[model samples]
Target: MIVLPRAMMPIIVACWLYYLLGVVVVGQYEWQTRDAFDEIRMRMDKVNDDNCQIQHLGDLYLPEDAVSHLPDIKDININPVFPNRTALLHLHNMALSRSFFWSYILQSRFIRPAINDTYDPGMMYYFLSTVADVSSNPYINASAIYFSSNMSYSPSYRGFFNKTFPRFAPRTFRADDFNDPIHLERISTRNTFTVQDLGAFPTTRLSDDYTTDFYRINEWYKKWLPDNVDKRHDTKTTYQIEIRYANNTNETFTFHGPPGADEYPGPVKWTRPYFDCGRSNRWIVAAVSPVADIYPRHTGFRHIEYPTYTAVSVMEMDFDRIDINQCPKGKGNSGPNRFANSARCKTDTTEVYI
Candidate 1:
């Protein structure tokens, strides 16, 4: 080691201390930067459950008579007949994709123009066109049937249901018998001529089960469950839909649903694959999600974090449309090429060739 003069010793010590401080500063910065990056990564990976929370409409404080008039949003009953594992996975993925699909549509810019102003029929057509255009994927099986949420509040939809498609009670068969346009027109004409010919048509061809009242419709559905499930139990299986408000208050509505299933408190959920006798009349699975509307509270104008239920949107897919093949079509069928002029060694030397 080279000896330094006593005057230069202080300078060398000062320089060494400065170098140490710089190293410590750099190390701390790197550590802080690493921590910040980790935080950002975690935020990116976090799954959002913002729409999963339930909202109670009772908190709105409507009159008791008005509240009683509100329609009950029904849930799809789960089917007891379990699908194969591959089919179940396929359906689950389909349900997830549909959940996103409907969610995007509900929050899309197109819906506001339709309902924001006085229910534009032209806007309704455009909205439905958008839905049809987006759902034109080949893999999704274009033949799959879908229906929008029932908007009894809207005059256009109400007229459509009243005159075009009369609401009928859910039955074992022919729930949609009156859905035919010809039948609907006949029914409308019969209602219109009620004052003129009261006693003339004493006996009618159609069943009297059909009605425009939603309350009657709910009662009809409550009497029955999905076709495949066991309805033998004395007590009907009911699912409690609990709606919690931001004010720490909640109200529950009990409706008939499949037994042994968890409560569906407003979220993207998959119903057990079931054979729907109505409309589709095939083996189907449904993805149901609630269409929510944010409302400002009456007292404080505070915005609730939970979403209030406006309507439930369902996306159905038939099982027949999906191919549930687990393996590749021709995996491991071909042999290695052996017709080349160059000779290759057979690795199995222990065995004698035939």
Candidate 2:
């Protein structure tokens, strides 16, 4: 049996009591923390389950037993961040308007004859100038605006002359037969002509000026190209001539056949995006339409004649210029837009709706 002093005994008891109180408090705190964490986990699981249910409902079919059903929800919530709609609208309108212009030219009496190689240079110049004056839309500063017509002649006629009466050939000086038998014989003897037999001959003639700049394009090409070195092609004189406004001036340009040249037989054709290294020196797209007769001719028989194509007109525009100021300024993909701003709305140029 050991006895302690009264003062020491009290101090030792006090120390033991302090230790017990600390253990109880710390255990209580730890238990509370664990309980709070479990509660948070349970809430998160409920939220996940609710989200799954909502997604599953989206894939379910409507109830057949319902008396009346609401119409489908078609209200699209397009935010202002979208700009593709705006850009697409602009492109579509531009293409549509250009189609109308080319269609009008092909339908005109003078222009159709011009394509067939019957018009005089003076008349062609006048026609080209008139078209250029109205070709530019007031809203866009087009990098280049041009029109091209090709004169394709084969001595064999490729069944074209066979379709017409024999009397129609010698009696009438058709577009293909400009100066009668002499011209026909001359063209038949050779594969190609160094000079243009027609007024708008692409190898030589321009809108108001003529040049030998594109003389290399005069040779026979299996395909249409200005500088086609591979001359081992069939016999066909397909040359394209242009009346153009580019480099702040009126001039004539020529091309054998670029990417979209042959597609004019169908509806208005738009070329894929391309880089114009020779002339425009920028990314561009071309719209081409063929010069075709609008009215059918009476063949004196029961059969009706359909429209025939002569030449193709082309319009080149800057790709960036077409898009203009339609895109949004933010970081994420701008989804769509409802309205497109035209030249009339934002530019000082003339107002023409697409």
Candidate 3:
């Protein structure tokens, strides 16, 4: 090897340092992204459910084609309804109540990271709003309790590499700050909308008001964004609708693309149940997050996208239907194979995790 000049040695060393910086920066970014998902699910799991209302619905299951099978499933224009003010407050606060790492922001030329645990209201809103916007299922938020768990993961010690990062998020996402997710608990009385003989379909975050009811929502969203955050705007969203049926089975559906014009016939997504003035069914609607390009593929963590989302949207809805069946404690989700103790069937609860 040729001997390098003394002056060149400093440049070589500088190059080496730059290389190490990328390794550390990239590694930190990847882990922070991975960990965000991990904490959310962990929080959701730790919380005790108030009780799944769906359990009461007799052991009914929606077939895969439940939506497509409907007599008029194709003729619907699914004008989504949104949550009420009380519910909105709860959702908005839960999202802004805590601090978190804005990993997506890391990629943004805009935001500059701060210290661990530094609160950034905007990122929280992004996380909360993204899930809510896609669909209004509470489980999506519930399972992501980690998003707000005010904990930090970046190593305390740093070399020159540390400088490469703007600043570690001051606060890690925490659930305690907000009530975790509103849906995980029983529907609040204020939000309850009963259907005569059937159970209730309390207003979820996905209610149309989220979009139309933009004023109050903005009060929270309008908060000072993390530095360099872009102004908020809407994007075309694709939501995968999941329903927990009466037979203790799951029915899944999604929008391959926008619905057709006119008759809106053929290959439509999500069953559009006619809302008779009386006597209707109850179900849970959980939302999954739209895909975020900032994250990597096969993120070991679950619930990153729909089975595979094309773009990031505001919310992800997962519905849990609770008809009046409380299937006799004998029916098994997989048949007699189901047990009361197993809490698994006529309870065949499957989730399309976001």
Candidate 4:
């Protein structure tokens, strides 16, 4: 073999050394990343046993062949058994595309929203709500499925990704607008009926179980523990829901969720024969903070610096109980979307036209 000149040998050795160093650096960085993930998970797993009771909703898994695509949003498709006000609406649990929501993956798994890609689970909390009534007059169905979107935390990449989707303006809109004309019937600033209905049906369903009148819905399950917000607001709201986790594993932790808006809170009790769950997006993920470590006292805003991921979700849902008038044939006992689970009624209403 011909021997290399001295300078060439140094250069070759330097190149080889550089490659070795890069491998080491990358491995170290990955290890650090994993360590950070462990910290986040440790913090997330801490459940305060003080004020609230733990209700483990369900666990997450790789999408099966049947549910690989998103399904009807209203059907409580994350897991069938856990009940909600309107199925405690657990949407999708997004991670770094390949990791669990809790694994510190999503924050760094930045992706560009391609053309016509509406929801980048990394970018926004797409709170999807459709007009609850599909009557001839779309505006009349002012009611909507309220209280969606868990608190989703995205890493602030140069500050663009950190801000919440402010409102309907030139830049963006609520994802619910995409729910098709049959459901979205022009209930916006344009409609006078929409204004009247928004005022009439202000039943903001909350993520947490709160104190209720305990009349028809007799639920005593306290909110998820390690309470950040003082108000278990749902307890005070007109309707309440409790989700018992389908998982028996003790590794479960209660994630903190953003409260649902009270402005367009739908009617307390209503049926939806008019609205079809099949017409809606099948799987919805309401992202929440994986770790909610601090909250400023005065503002009542939870200060979060945690990554977001969810292991449990509802794959299917059936209303635990609805009026005999709506689920007349005991359809409530059946899984989601059997008959007229669409009818909404008040606890006091004796005469339901539906």
Candidate 5:
């Protein structure tokens, strides 16, 4: 046997200690991944529950008692129209849209850990605008009551709209705000027009003025924003267009001028519909942030490249035309109504009580 130097023993001990530490670190990482998975599962379950409740509410007609229940109903229209086949189709579309939105929210908020995150209050405002668009359909709005309940429980969401949204002063409406010719000229100057514009300009005029109209409808929201905050010159401020069909189905579209192209000079990004156009029917345009500029922390949580425009246009078909029987239970048939398969038909109806 050869004798070893005493110094060699310390080296051996140090190596052993390092190996142990590595094992401990790996173990901790494994545990964290498992925890993340479990949390995601729980959130998914809650979403499913909320979805079921929303579905139930949508299915409830309450024709005889509808008048008496007006105040209690989540979406109360004075003279409500019963859903026709087209309307049912609309409902299906709306449900799917809402489902997609909430699913994305769950993935971002609970499933994924925040990494190099920036918060943009505009995104939340856009989300609200999207929700409002869908809510125009009474059934869709009724379904959304369930979603609002769920969102109220989220901390990130609360921090976004309740705390941060008011910090950026929004744009004021002038005749130019509704002036489509000037608006179109501005948009054209920025090279915003394309076959894939996703119907953002339904008309040349401001058919819907979100800034003024939204404040009028949601008085409480006005007070939620800070009083001293400057409403002008916030690049994050945006104008969004949301369209909902009679079925309570909807889509949200967003548009913003490029940074330095107009009075507002800063980066802007649109969300609502998915980020990938191939997967969705929504469109978004954003001005890229300057390369050298330092953005405030937690300013824009979801960032895509600047000077980049992306549109997501998910093919939508009239749900009534779908022949549910033709397609097998789990397999999707080719053509427009690919989403009509029963496998994708996830419903939530528990929100309707009696």
Candidate 6:
């Protein structure tokens, strides 16, 4: 190469140095921006658990004489032989979508006026009363009323109930129930209800033989390990439900049964004709362990900081147990569909009039 003059050499060197510095500075800036974005994402995730609105309808209409305690109903001694595991898996997915979000979003907003205007509250109440009549868990039956009311009023996003409640009416409710029916319907109708693929997390094994009753189990657990019982051991198992929106906003929700203190607290009793063992029934009851370390798949995210999870404890009753007499007779088969083939009542010969 031809030798450059002293003055030209200095200029060339300076140009090269500037280019190198530019690359380094840009690289550093990009990395910091990415890190900042990730940190904000992690902090936003923590709100996901709190942002969720899961309403618990507990013991709203159960007669004092009925199975009032959580232990009594939980101790029904019925081994759920998942007959059609496929169906249950499907039902679980359906319930996750319909009962939780879909109904809340669609029917609560766009369809609320139609439901309220066309159907009398008494009719809805009658249907709910019928459900309570045959359900083994009165809490579940009564809770349906709350669901109905929510679907009727179409509360805004600010007015939604964020915490668990035994009972609530339109007049008295939380701020989260803001009346954003349009937005709610948009999210609910578009979101797909499917099992999320969380990478991996720590898992705690559950005892095959364990008490379902909260009080007795807590007492026994406390006594069983008097020295130092790990809090994780007392924690309920939870599932990570990841919902990816069209806008590329992803939210992961943690769903678990009631804690040891709530009534009917435990893994939902799976029964035949309901939950069958198969790929559909892949989701098992959460083991007693803290949510953070339980689902390895979700916890395995190395790049993104995961959010703190929560427990959604609601009393679920077998729809099949509802008595047909309590149901109203309607013009079509749509009204008061009874659970005639439920395993709980196999021998009942009661004729369904509706």
TM-score of each: 0.28, 0.28, 0.21, 0.19, 0.20, 0.19
Ordered list by lDDT, greatest first? 2, 1, 5, 3, 6, 4
Tens digits of per-residue lDDT, candidate 6, 173-264, equal 01122334756644332121222111111223122111122211122122111122243443433344576889998876554422232334
Query: Per-residue lDDT of 18-68 in model 3, one digit per residue for the tens?
Result: 999989888854232333224333433432233322232212222221211
Candidate 2 or 6, higher TM-score? 2
Give the per-residue Cα lDDT of candidate 2 at 18. Answer: 93
Model 4 weakest lDDT span, ten residues long: 165-174
Q: Give the alpha carbon lDDT tens digit for every residue of 1-354 in model 4.
A: 998898799889999999999998887642323332243233334422231123232211111211111223333344454333332222221111111222222221222332332222432232211221212222122222111123333333223333332111001112233334654565433222121111122246332112233211111111122334433323211212233446843332333322222322311111211111111211222212122221211122334333221211111122212222233335334433222233333436467686
Output the lDDT of residue 11, model 6. 90
lDDT of each: 0.31, 0.32, 0.27, 0.26, 0.29, 0.27
- The C-alpha stretches of model 5 lying farther than 4 A from their native spots are 1-83, 109-112, 116-354
Q: In model 3, where is the ten-residue run with the lowest total lDDT?
A: 165-174
lDDT of 5 by residue, 161-272 (tens): 2332211211111011233565764432222211221122233434222223321221212212112224343433333457687999886744332222233312221111
Candidate 2: segments with Cα more than 4 A from true spot: 1-135, 138-266, 294-305, 322-354
For candidate 2, the per-residue lDDT at 176 reads: 21
TM-score of 3: 0.21
**Which window of ten consecutive residues has the lowest lDDT sum in model 6?**
282-291
lDDT of 2 by residue, 115-187 (tens): 3333222323424432442243422212112222222222223223223211110000002224456675545
What root-mean-square deviation over C-alphas does model 4 reach? 30.1
Question: Mind sharing the TM-score for model 4?
Answer: 0.19
TM-score rank order: 2, 1, 3, 5, 6, 4
